[model samples]
Each structure stands twice: as structure tokens, then as C-alpha cells.
Target: MIKKEWILQKALEQFNERGYSEVGVRELARMLEISPGNLSYHFSKKEDILIALLEQFSARNSSFYEHYLTLSPTNAHFLELMEKIFNSQYEYRGVYIGNQYVRTELQSQDRFDYQSIATKRASTFQKIFQGLDAAGQLRVNGEDIAFLVAHITLFGRFWISEATLFTKFPDKNKTIRHYLFLLAKQLSLFATEQGKKSIEEFSRGMS
Candidate 1:
């Protein structure tokens, strides 16, 4: 039973590392040192495994966002929250990458299930933005709208896979950081003049 759990966990990691289509269920069973029948016993199909992984991802990310929102508004909090966007992208990179490994997994799955997952994942983000808005720290339109803005903040950096990203520095981590800095700089302007002045004063002191 413990070995079975380890195999399941590795399957999730392998799905991410190599993508879903390339990683055959039979091979996964082999790697797990188990019969295909056993894996099928727990998860009837590969699509079933993908759905379970997505569900776990959704719950984990939602809980994380909820915890982050409980923190008071601060530039650091804002930055951390934005970093989460990349982290999420990396976790689900294959979903966005097309005509390849990730695309195959998506095609094998139910479209309605994918749509529902997207909607549910989006709500956690909306709540986090709403928290910031309630504290008068955000300059965005509304929580729902703001969620879209925040998500789009990383548009240039995301990839279905590294191949889809730029060649010079395929890693999007640096690009994501640049966006986070830009976001905090622009959003900090929402503070009162005195608050803004204090920020300037701090910059001067640092200089």
C-alpha cells in the first residue's frame, strides 16, 4: 500500500516533468513495480489520474491563497502573491502548452471538467484581490476584474513548456520578478500622498 502511494506521487511528478501524453500508464505501473491492473484498480484511467492531480492542485493553491490573504497589506505580501502566479504556471505548464505532450493530456480529458477547474481556481485569486481591495491597497477595478489583471501580469512569462518561452533565458522566473517589481511600484501609488512621500523618503535614505 505504501509503495502504491509512492508510485502515485511519482506519477504526478512524472506527468509534470515529462508531461501526460508521453508518460504511459503501463510504463508508470512498471516504474511503480506494480501490475497495470493495480494502478487501474486505484485509478481506472489515465484521464482519471489527470483529474485527480488537477483537483489536488486546485485545493492546494486555493488554500495557499486564502492563507496569504489573511496577512495585512504590504509590499512584500503583494510581491509574494504575484510570485504565486508563476508557481502556479509551472505547476500546470502542460495545460497551456499545445500540440504536444500537454496537449495530448488535455485532449484526452473532458473539456467541461477543465472549464470547471479553471473557474474554481479563479475564485481563490478573486478572493485574494478582494482582500487587498478591502484594505484600500489595490488600484484595480474590482476583485473579479483585478484577478484577471493580476493573472495577465505574467502573460509574457508563461509557457506550456520551455520551448514555447524565449531561447535566451527560457526560465520565466526572472521575467516574473520584473513584473512583480513593476506591480508593487505602480500599486504603491495608491497610498496617500504622505504615504507616497514616506516611500520616497525611504528611497532617499537608502540612497
Candidate 2:
């Protein structure tokens, strides 16, 4: 890997294993076996590395949203999408779980407009639900759609933090399945009969 990519990879690993506050740029240089000055050439502050990592995370989520837009919407398909979402959250657990520290450090940076990001995410969820409603998989009205979107956006953003508390060992697949169940259950409340059936089949397949 090139030096910049190498630095991000090592930094992500250390950040995920140890909380972001505990890791420093000098320690990252030591881990990369490079001089501190060289590391600074790529990322001057630890927050710079954090911003890069968050960019990567945002890109991955955008790709997933784009891909799903092309697929036929179904309850099963939505569940599958949730699985991918949870997996990505697990992969970047450090960022999601240590969100307080992240927010504190990046609050004044102005590099990321978190409110805008949240707005876009809610818009995406609206599209997904609208698609499902057209597909006859979901029976949701405009008011309920707003409610569901709000809860879903909240849950998706912070589920990792909550999961880490109850999970001792944190097996990726198991943690994903647990959260998926809760998400699927929430959807079932607004799902059509066909949607319920699709979810049932999906749940059975997961077992």
C-alpha cells in the first residue's frame, strides 16, 4: 500500500482496538515504523485521520444506498440491507461506539455537516419506505413514514453504541443478527401481510 493508505489502515486498526482518545499520532507512527514527521505529512492531527476514516465510512454507506435504489424493493431485500448496514457499523465500531469522543473533537472542525448528513440519511430511508409501499410490502402513511424514518435513522446511527454495552465478546455475525431481529420486528409493525411473510422467510433463513 502507498504511505497514505497504509497510515489510514493502521490508524483504523488502532482506533478500533483502542478507543480514539487513547491513540496518538506518535503511537500511530510507531505502529507504522515511520518517523512522526513523515506521518504528519499524511495526517497532521489525529482528527485528520478520523475525518478520513469517517469519509470512507460515509462513502461505503452511499454506495449501499445507491445499490439498493437499483434493486426491487421487498421486505426481505430491506432486511438484507439492514444486515449490510449493521455489518458496516460493526466494521467501524470504534467510530460509532466512541461517538461522544468523536463529536467532542470534531464539533468545531466544520469539515463535516452532521445535520446535513442526517437529513440525507433520513431522505434515503424515506425513499426506501416509499419503494416498499409501492411494492405492496409496506403499509405506511405519510405520518407513519415520518415516524418510522425518525426512529430508523436514530437506531441506525447509535445501535453500535447500545450493542457494545450488552455484548461481552461481540461476535460480528451474532451481533448483526440480534440487531437485525429488532429492526425486522419494527418493520413488521408497518408491514403488509406479504411483507410479514417475506420477513418470516428471511428470519427462518437466518436461523
Best by lDDT: 2
lDDT of 2: 0.84
Q: Write the per-residue lDDT of candidate 1 for residues 1-207, one digit (tens) a residue.
A: 735356557887776666577788899888888889988888877776666666665666666667677887643564565567566656565433332654466766563265565555566556655655566655456754564555543342343344444442345665555555555566565544444443454334323
RMSD of each: 5.4, 1.6
Q: In angstroms, give how far residue 201 of model 1 lies from its true place.
A: 14
Candidate with the greatest TM-score versus the true structure:
2
List candidate 2 segments past 4 Å from native: 166-169
* Alpha carbon lDDT of each predicted model: 0.58, 0.84
Lowest lDDT sum, 10 consecutive residues, model 1, at 152-161
Alpha-carbon runs more than 4 Å astray in model 1: 2-5, 92-112, 120-136, 140-207
For candidate 2, what is the total of clashing residue pairs?
0
